[model samples]
Target: MNGPGGYFGGCLTALDDCLRGTFGYTAPATLLWRDASTAREHLSRALTAEGRPYDLFAGTLQVLAEGGMHVTLA
Candidate 1:
């Protein structure tokens, strides 16, 4: 992933930078560049067991808001 419109996935460095500028959480505790199988497992963990999306979305919104970032949802 690169910056605004990366093809594979969102650039986590960009996300971390966004969070740093906003809520003071930076650099990341973990960054996983997964192969396809591991990536599926990761998604499963987030969507079900950890429920990461529900927890993360609002905080992400806040970070983006604080950073004055506006994205068009298309």
Candidate 2:
């Protein structure tokens, strides 16, 4: 939650509010903010030597999350 609402006032609550309003249900959602720059740096030097752009990966995940199968990020 932002400002004075603490955890209850932030994005998760916002999501819950939205879902409750739109679908007549409220549920928790896991939020994952991956450290992509660090990931890319390590990936470039170690594993693949080439890594997919952060946006591509994030967008794919976004699509899956919005697919309405009750998937939650971790």
Candidate 3:
């Protein structure tokens, strides 16, 4: 999988940056997957709290999925 740092990798980096800025930390990809709902919830809350549109994150996830990324939420 093309991870953060490449052309197709910025999504994870973006997520990490967002999370770090909002929650003071970053989560491992595996852990994020393991607790997908909680992760999304935190992201949603943070984005809303910060006055950013939550659709940005949702759109990124959609793009990732369309790009063949396997992100199991359950």
Q: Which candidate should be chosen as best, given lDDT against the real structure?
A: 3
- The candidate 1 region of ten consecutive residues with least summed lDDT is 25-34
Residue 16 of model 1: what lDDT? 47
Count backbone clashes in candidate 2.
Answer: 2
Q: Between the candidate structures 1 and 3, which one is better when assessed by TM-score?
A: 3
Q: What lDDT score goes with residue 34 in model 2?
A: 55
RMSD of 3: 9.9
Q: Please, what are the lDDT tens digits per residue for candidate 3 over residues 1-74?
A: 23343323345556544444543332333222556677577665445446776654476566455444456675
Tens-place lDDT per residue, model 1, 3-59, is 333332264346646455544433333333236454444443344245544333444
Q: Which has the higher lDDT value, candidate number 2 or candidate number 3?
A: 3
Highest-scoring model, TM-score: 3
Q: Which stretches of candidate 1 lie over 4 Å from their true place?
A: 1-54, 71-74
TM-score of 1: 0.31
- Every candidate's lDDT: 0.43, 0.41, 0.49
